[model samples]
Target chain A: MTRHYNFCAGPAALPTAVLERAREEMLDYHGRGLSVMEMSHRSPEFVAIAEQAEADLRELLAIPENYKVLFLQGGASLQFSMVPMNLLGQGGTANFLYTGIWGKKALAEAKQLGFAVHMAGSSEASGHTEVPTQAELALSSDAAYLHYTANETIGGLEFDYIPDVSVPLVCDYSSSILAEPLDVSRFGVIYAGAQKNIGPAGLTLVLVRDDLLDQRCQRIPSLFDYQAVAEAGSMVNTPPTYAWYLAGLVFQWLKHDIGGLEAMATINARKAAKLYAAIDSSGLYSNPIALRNRSRMNVPFVLADERLDKPFLAEAEEAGLLNLKGHRSVGGMRASLYNAVPEAAVDTLIDFMADFEQRRG
Target chain B: MTRHYNFCAGPAALPTAVLERAREEMLDYHGRGLSVMEMSHRSPEFVAIAEQAEADLRELLAIPENYKVLFLQGGASLQFSMVPMNLLGQGGTANFLYTGIWGKKALAEAKQLGFAVHMAGSSEASGHTEVPTQAELALSSDAAYLHYTANETIGGLEFDYIPDVSVPLVCDYSSSILAEPLDVSRFGVIYAGAQKNIGPAGLTLVLVRDDLLDQRCQRIPSLFDYQAVAEAGSMVNTPPTYAWYLAGLVFQWLKHDIGGLEAMATINARKAAKLYAAIDSSGLYSNPIALRNRSRMNVPFVLADERLDKPFLAEAEEAGLLNLKGHRSVGGMRASLYNAVPEAAVDTLIDFMADFEQRRG
Candidate 1:
């Protein structure tokens, strides 16, 4: 079967090797006589699968021994409410640096849920074309934790430097968790939606320092209580078993196939650099983000003429590139070079963009 | 590859045909060039799959036009919170008819979440051998809704009759949904976890009458708000895309391969009957629940000698009858005869049981 270049922002592409492995084992995993989807989460096979995935992830990220990695359901949207409920239970303000839509949504969820919240800083003044510098960020005196999105998928803005904060550092690293090496000890909690660079949509990855688990709110749902979820090994109830297994496959791919995040970072940097260079050189295309803070994961670019948007997307799809259309709210073109997206996809996209410019510019 | 009989209670067996279709499309869905797992939730292709799954479910259950079917993440455990948050918004006491572990968990969630709750009725005094009758159930004076589990998977108990309540009726139909014909108009809201009879883990299905959508509690997470989720067509966030697609395949299998639920019910009835008859006739085996209230979906039985449990499980696995061990809380054996388990699997299980009894009795 012919596989096309997929560039959707979230629920983006997966490693072809991982997909092939999943396909080979979809009906019966390792001669277990039943699909992973049908197995009990508590079964020996699935538990091993679950543990290995977490272990592999820990190795790849060099996570500290005391951190608990949770494979949970409900993705980042659920985590938005959970982060505040868990971290602010001892009654400190939830602080956020809103760079784009996702970070804003995280802030909004906490605010709507009646949690005391502080918006420390935002790039809103620049139409989210750049992230506020560390000097511009403001942390409240009683901040429980400072939360930020590492990479804004829609806005195409990445934090050039981590916000230095006195409080526990938390991050919504949904769009760029495994793209490069990370200092896990620097954050109290780091969570990512698995749809982007990890595996599938249902499973969310949460890595929390052991000290942070105890402050979870008492009255929240047991599933929402980080302490309870961790105590039970993230299987308080039936987890998304198949999705977790698929994520394990992805972790394995990252470790063995891509030679861990160091190698992945190298490849990702090159891919994004090539695409950005293509846009910068082309007369018909332009990107708005500040060069230093430009996202290596998601790059949103626009054509010279607004009228070319529809044809650009259509022709991109015809040339075997899909999901080139940007977020609906922002009418433009975006190519998300997630970890699973091959470098060849960027090369092909750049060539197509060059050809299109010659034909229509 | 050899496919064995899997009787996992929750992340139970799926229709082999459905699994086959999923395997075929695991790498590239209908030549779309990317796996369904890799597609955007808002993409037209994935949206169509989501809508079709909902539509098929509505048709299968003869759901009322006013009801909204939501394909959501987080299983019944999350619904334990959402139900109270949504239904108790107007500030009435949540009433529950507790039969077993699942129902108790549902009640405990409402209680722990600081909601005013009433224990209307329960069969706990009788060791959960039967469900509390409609006449025995006590609805509170200010009952916002009366909630109950349609079938307790661990306790192997099923409600023989629907409770007639003055207030709205909500049921956690997680284990028994789609086992037979259901009157969708009877309940105000019915929810089930997808792992059992629907498809795989990670997807939860909620069918709620339109009138109940309003009155959701203020300050709950947006993902937890039923009204917002419904209005957005369950697209408030990225859903478990591949799980939803697999569920769609299952719905198609139930409709086309099995000739809908009537034929499915007949087969399921026959399968459950043969197994129960085998248990009743065997000197070595016994099921605890009352015959009429015994779950047709989950049949938890014990051998005459508890010492034989381990060997029985080992032999069962050897015979290619997998996951026959009961819930860890009650350590005997349980055979879940979900719609996908097939009559042949039941026949094979019965023959194995008879042969085992003859040798060990």
Candidate 2:
């Protein structure tokens, strides 16, 4: 079977090996006479699978003991409301560092839920070209938490350093998470939708400091309550069981075959460097983000001649490299190199970019 | 390859043909060179898949043109809140008919969200042995909607008739949906979690009337707004793409292979009749539910000697009939014969039950 390189922003590419294994085991899982999708979530068989997925994730991220790992639904967007609902106990101001579209949308959702939201820093005025330096940010002392997107999938900007602050740090790491190494202790909460570096779109991963668990506002539904999900081991209600199963397979694939997060980080860095170098060298293409803040996962670049954008994407599709179009908000080209993207695929993309540039010149 | 018949209540069995096709196409769907899971939700390819799924569902249910079908996330539990948030305009009362655990949970969530909740009728006092009669129900004239569970998975009860109501009729068809023919136009809204009769756990089906779209209460999150999801064709957020895809496959399988809803109804009736007849004829086992209101989808029964429960379940497991234990709230045995359950599997279960009874006697 032909395997095209998928570069969709999310509901994104998965490891080919995981998909093959899932296919082989689709009829009956481990002699259970039932597909993993058909098993009861409460059954010992499934409980073990869920627990192992969580354990593997913890090991991959080196998650601190003080944090609780939660597998939740409703995506990262839901977390926008859940984070404020859980963290903004009795109501207080929250600071936001706006880098791109995602951070803006998240802040908008938080504000609707009654948080006194403040823009600590914003790159929107500069077309989201750079991440704000610590000195340039205006964090509030009275803020319940400081929110930021670690990597902006749309604008393709990424933070190079953790913002030093006294307030609790909450980062939407939907795109950049697990693409490289992370210091788990640096933040109060880190949440990522699994579609990118993790697994599928249905499961959302939230790692919260244990202390943060007790601050949930009462009257929130049990399903939205972080404390409730954490207490029930993320099975507060029936979870997205099939997605969780696939995620388990993904975790296993990541740990054993892909080499743990440390090795993954090296590969991710090399991949990013190769693509960035190609874009910088080409007269026909340019990535607008400030060099220090350019995302290692989402590489958004525009053709020097804007009229060639559609033709560029069509040709790339014909070459079996798909979903290279940028976000509608930023019309150009984007090649997302998440963990599942192989080095050979990156080399292929670079080669195509060079050939295209030469042909256009 | 050996395939064990799965009898899980929800997250239950899927058609074997669908599973096989999914497995075959898991790596490269129709030469797209990417699994359906990897496709972008907004792409034309996935859009066609989503639209086709909705069209197939519409055709199967004979859905009215005045209604909208929404594919949503967060399961039926989220709808417990979303229904009130969307339909209970200005804190209006919504009448509930509590057949079992699901209705009570939905009512509790609506109450939490500030809806004036009233119990029109409830069979909980009789241990949910039967659905309430029309004369016993007391739906208010000012009620925004009247809610009921069409089939209770936990208590094994089902409605014998649709209640005549001036206000909108809303039903949670989580377990019984698609197992038999349903008149879609009779209700203002119908919702079902996909785990039982549809496909997987992460996706939910919502059919709402056009009139219900105008009742949105302010301050509901856009993601939770039924109107927003309906308008966007459920692409308002990154949906549970893989779950939705699988549900589409199940819809196709049901339509073509299972011979549509009428055929499904005939098969489901036969399966239920056989199991109920066995329970009635044998002095060794009894199903407590009232005959008229008993669920065709869920068959809950008790051994004459309650002490044999453990042995019965253990022996059943050895015989390859799994997950027969009843819900913890009511201890006995429950066989959820959803649409995917075959006649032979029911026959196998009956044979085992008879043999076990003879040994005990």
Among all candidates shown, the one with the greatest TM-score: 1
Q: What's the lDDT for candidate 2?
A: 0.89
* Residue range B1-361, candidate 2, lDDT tens digits: 6787677897899999989999999999999999999989998888888989999999999999999999988889988988888897665698999988999999999888667889999997887897889989898767888999999998889999999888889999999999877888899999999999999888889999998897978777778888888888888779999898899999999999998999999999999999999999998999888999999998999988999999999888888898898887888899999999999999999998889989993
lDDT at B292, model 1: 77
Backbone clashes in model 1, listed as residue pairs = none
Candidate 2 has which clashing residue pairs, if any? none
Instruction: Categorize the docking of model 1.
Output: high
Instruction: Please provide, for model 1 over B1-361, each residue's C-alpha lDDT reduced to its tens digit, 9 standing for 90 to 100.
Output: 9899999897999988998898888778888998998999998999899889988988999998999999898899999999999988889999999999999999999999999999999999889997888789878899999999999999999999988888889999999999888998899999999999998999999999999988788878889998999999988999899999999999999999998999999998899999999999999999989877989999999999998888889999999999999998998999999999989999999999999889987
Question: Over all chains combined, what TM-score does candidate 1 have?
Answer: 0.99
Model 1: TM-score for chain B: 0.99
Give the alpha carbon lDDT tens digit for every residue of A1-361 in model 1: 8899999997989999998999889888899999999999999999999999989999999999999998899989899999999988889899999899999999999999999899999999999988898889898898899999999989999998877888999999999999999999899999999999999999999999999988987778889988888889999999999989989999999999999999999999999999999999999999999999999999999999989888888899999999999899897999999999999999999999999999998
